[model samples]
Target: MKADRIVSVIFILIALVFWSQTFGLQYNCSIFPHLILIFLILSSAIMFAQTFFAKDIKREHLSGKDLKYIIISIAIVFVWIYMLDFLGFIVSSVICLSILTLILDQKRPMPVRTLSSVAIYTLMVLVFWFIFHKFLLVPLPTGYLI
Candidate 1:
């Protein structure tokens, strides 16, 4: 099997296991995860099947630098989740989103670019905060200090 086929098959297995695990959740909580997992399973099956028919198709691969940056971004998101309760949603999200935006932009005039990205994401986070807390009636984490 080609590398792409192997990866697709692995992900299909993973999605099956993940979808199955959602069955243990309460009915209300399980519904969203079920939808997402089913989507993943279907997409993976399509990819795996395409691998056999699309041998002539060119496959795109990420450069080592891009792969490294992608891995680092994933780590940052996991860390952001772990720290959310301790640092609070607003503060931790600001930091993480700012960093992610800057990483993706990487333009000239370093200070200006950094500041613009930070400002934009901060505003975005604030809008989400208002929507979730005010309209949706969901309470967000407020850290000990904040």
Candidate 2:
């Protein structure tokens, strides 16, 4: 049981759990989730299968700094989700995406670069907002900011 196999197996189990829960959803509501879950299961299954045939399996150990980064990123994601209802999708997404970009970025944070990064994230969020809220007629979580 290599790392890839273990991760794929875990994803498959998680997908199975979500798949079961989708049964209670309305047909229309469940369709997207089902499609995504099916994709997850298929990809994980393929990865699991590939793990066996993969040669020269090099297991890289996570350093303390990398582990810290992972923990921080996960915490940021949780905070972003929690903020969505209060700050709305656009505000929360832009803020969180900016933070994530700053954290993951290794380059020196110049003023123009940081601003551009934020602008890019804002544009991306707005595009998604328009697609889901306007184009698809799907109501997104709205708050004071949006």
Root-mean-square deviation of each candidate, in angstroms?
3.7, 3.0
lDDT of 2 at 93: 97
Q: How well does candidate 2 score on lDDT at residue 80? A: 94
Worst 10 residues of 1 by lDDT: 100-109
Where is model 2 poorest over a 10-residue stretch in terms of lDDT? 51-60
Candidate 2 global Cα RMSD: 3.0
- Residue 134 lDDT (model 1): 87
Task: Give the alpha carbon lDDT tens digit for every residue of 36-101 in model 2.
Answer: 999999999999998888785667899999999999999999999999999999999999999998
Quickly count the clashes in candidate 1: 0
How many clashes show up per model?
0, 0
lDDT of each: 0.84, 0.93
Top candidate (lDDT) = 2
- 99-130 in candidate 1: lDDT tens per residue? 77767665643888788878888799889989
